[model samples]
Target: MIIGYVTNFNLNQLDFNIKLKIQSDKFISSNCRKQYVKYLLDFEFRKNFHCIGIPIIKDPPKDSFVIGHHFFNDQENRKIGSYIFSYCFEKRHYVNLPDFTFNTLLILSHPKSGMLHFKDRNKRILFIKPKPKYISLCTSREDICGPIFMKQKANIIKKIDIEVDDNCEIGDNCICKNKTLKESENDLKFIYFVPKNTN
Candidate 1:
């Protein structure tokens, strides 16, 4: 089933393309069962971005699966990033296992954003919130510090009442702050389901 849609395009063709990529992957073919393989395709038309997450498992348990998110820049025809993760069903919510690569930890450190994918037969995309432990790991990386600081700068400015230069404008450069920013809490609502048809 198609989890998301694109306007003015043949979904069958899009589905075919997704399947073709999976079929061509020898590792997925050799390790995962074709019949059980599921695809979560997300298209950000404004960004010209296409992301496909495939759960690669040889024999997935009824309540858990391992997935890898593959993101691509459609305009550039290049991959942006690919990160693998494992999730398991618990207390009616899917919990992310801590098994993550260093790069994956960096991506998760960004505030209020996490990986989205289809992990079940539901018609909504499962949004896995970033764990605080993972976010802390990113602070030690000098390269990622700049981008993360920039992304959260607006919030910092607000809290500190810092004055900005009149010449500065809030846009992609400065104003894009995390909408869901809140005090660090262990019980913050994490699991979110974005309806497939909303976009």
Candidate 2:
């Protein structure tokens, strides 16, 4: 299950869209998949914004889970962000967003979780499980700022300070910040993923 917002910031208006994708090998029949997709298409977490999910015929790789957000623009965006935030909180997961709103891929996943290969080695990537209060701050804004802000204001979510290693892999259920990949000299692109224990 993946959910996040995509933003297109223009001079006059901002195009905010919510997207979701659920890949499973258990959808046995095409009709079942189509119906599930239809359900997601019709389901509205907010009044006017509906989640968009593309159904695939082929099975996705195992233990796939990816999450991130782009930007928030209005009450609708906040509502959707809050929805995703609440879901993550209930499941004890984390959410991270960039510092600014730009054209970027917001979600990535694979069935078999291991080292992920990327064409762009210089891409800056950081993974952190922000404190719960900070997660709430992310869903209350209607502007073009990332989760980390320079100045603390009524709407700004302040930047979190934490020490990070040059390059390290974060384990499941760990809480840390600034574990960045861009700081490493080695071509390290792998993000190991262990399936969450549902039991």
Best by TM-score: 1
lDDT of 2 at 62: 32
lDDT value, residue 197 of candidate 2? 23
Q: TM-score for every candidate vs. truth? A: 0.23, 0.17
Please, what are the lDDT tens digits per residue for candidate 2 over residues 82-169?
1111002233333231111111111233221223222221131122112111121122233323222112233232333223332334
lDDT of 1 by residue, 1-199 (tens): 5566767766553322221112123233335422122222232222322222333345555664433232323333322333232333232222233322212111212233333222221222212222211111111111111111111121111111222234423343231132332332221111222222233
Worst 10 residues of 1 by lDDT: 134-143
For model 2, which pairs clash? 61-111, 62-111, 62-112, 115-190
150: Cα error in model 2, Å: 11
